[model samples]
Target: MNPPDNPSANRWLVTACLAQVQAMRYTPAGLPALDMVLEHESQQHEGGGERLARASIKAVAFGPLAERLARQALGSCWNFRGFLAAGRGGKGLVFHIQDMQNT
Candidate 1:
């Protein structure tokens, strides 16, 4: 299916720490793939109250990004630019990372 005409509509930018990383694997097409978890914690104002927001999200990167992420140290923080999509079997959302930079 074709993507939406407005690319920014689905884009997601998150700043979080790398919580865990699995062994690098290859797709059937031989492209490198990496799966990992990212942890985010911050304080935000909601409903006129201060709230602590914490999240742990499942994420994946493909090809060169995957390879590069594999070499990064766990617990490192980064600014991740990506998009979200349903995972295999139409399960929960998975963040498909497109680019990242140290934070």
Candidate 2:
């Protein structure tokens, strides 16, 4: 089956620590951008079983979000709301962060 052009359920919100943060950059459009890695570790119930889930995902933020994230220290915890998408010319998933807040 063919998929929708823009899937509505591709959203992801994870409260994770900033494992790493790269220097900020600007897109060709002159929008501020920052790249970072988020680490999430928690216990979750899956298939009626308890499991310890740990994940590390690459994330990018733009505009004001990028400016805000740039000042955050590594290892700081925040609740990030974003969507999943393929990395730029890379493999696996990359989180496109839109909003974030301290937890």
Candidate 3:
């Protein structure tokens, strides 16, 4: 089935810590790109019980955001605003970060 055309349909926001960051790379079109992983941990109520939630997700940022993220300290937490898209080779989801703010 075709996906919805609404721009907000793919929006994603998460609070996480920077886990890993690869060296800055330039796309063929000369845009700065940076790939990284974000780790999140929290306690949530599930099934009427408290549970610890954790996740490590792959993400990417381009242009100025890429340059800014590349300079952030590892393990620092931030509120990430972005959208999800297929990863390389359609393997898995990759978060396309649009903005970030201190958490």
TM-score of each: 0.93, 0.89, 0.95
Runs of candidate 2 exceeding 4 Å displacement? 1-7
Off by over 4 Å in 3: none
Q: Rank order by lDDT, top first?
A: 3, 1, 2
Over 1-103, each residue of candidate 3 has an lDDT whose tens digit, in order, gives 8879886998999999999999999999999999999999999999999999999999999999999999999999999999999999999999999999999
* 1 against 2, candidate with superior lDDT: 1
List per-prediction Cα lDDT, in the order shown.
0.96, 0.92, 0.97
Q: How does model 1 score by TM-score?
A: 0.93
- Per-residue lDDT of 37 in model 1: 98
Please give the RMSD to the true structure for each candidate, in Å.
1.6, 1.9, 1.0
Preferred candidate (lDDT higher): 2 or 3 = 3
lDDT of 1 by residue, 1-103 (tens): 8978997999999999999999999999999999999999989999999999999999999999999999999999999999999998999999999999988
Q: In candidate 2, residue 84 scores what lDDT?
A: 90
**Candidate 3, clashing residue pairs?**
none
User: Per-residue CA lDDT of candidate 2, range 1-103, in tens?
Assistant: 6877877778889999999999999999999999999999999999999999999989999999999999988899999998998899878889999889889
